[model samples]
Target: MTSIIQTQELSYEAAIKMCVAVTQHAHQLGVSVGVVVVTPAGVELASVRMNNAPLHALSIARKKAYTAASFKIPSFNWQERLKHKPDTMSALLREENFTYLGGGIPIIVEGKLFGSIGVSGATEAQDIECAEHAITEQLNSL
Candidate 1:
């Protein structure tokens, strides 16, 4: 029999900090957005939606976070990675929690993945910028 193992997961405080950072960045850009952070197991730790952000953004942000944590890759990369693989692309698209758009980013530290952050409710570029800013701010705080 094999024994089960565990690894470091994202802390609630860290997840909230990430969401705040992304929200601040979006505010600075004069954009309303939604942000979500998830653990390595794809469990949501924290989430926020700006006052004017679309209601749909809440679910989208969560999906992005889940996808990033589940795959350990930037959500945007999936689009390019699957561009030439129609079958794979179609299959992935069929997933209820999968998103190939930008704004999802994995949080890796010391070669270990802690979780992921996702932003939505703005242009893809804007969403990506917010996600990146959150990561940079989180790293700096550490």
Candidate 2:
């Protein structure tokens, strides 16, 4: 029997660090965003909404994280597919809690997917940039 080393899921510390980095990045960019960090099963680990952020941004960010963690694909890809394939998109849209938008990113550790992080409230591009920077700057440090 080949014994495999066990890798743990995301820690509260990691989630907090990622959240701080994400929120700071958004502030530096002048974007008031809502961010969500979720486990692989779509459970939220941490969430934050900046002051003056849109009310819908919290739900949007959560959906983005759920979509990425459940589908194992970037949320923007679903958005693109939805634009080109309405029927398929409709089916996917019907899938419980999936979203088609930017700002969702999977967190990979030791070649395994741990969970996802998502940001919303700015332009799609800016949302994505904030999420990416969070992972690159904070998650990597963990």
Q: Give RMSD to native, each candidate.
A: 1.2, 2.5
Task: Encode model 1's per-residue lDDT on 1-142: one tens digit a residue.
Answer: 6598879987999899998999999999999999999999888899999999999988998888888988999999998999999999999989998999999999999888999998999999999999999988988888
Per-residue lDDT tens digits for candidate 2, residues 18-122, read 888889999999989999999988889999999999999989999999998988788998776678788998898787678888999888767788889999999
Q: Which pairs clash in model 2? A: none
Each prediction's TM-score versus the true structure: 0.96, 0.89
Error of 2 at 69 (Å): 0.5
Off by over 4 Å in 1: none
* RMSD of model 2 against the true structure: 2.5
Model 1 TM-score, all chains together:
0.96
lDDT on C-alpha atoms for all candidate structures:
0.92, 0.87
State how far residue 88 of model 1 sits from its true place (Å). Answer: 1.2
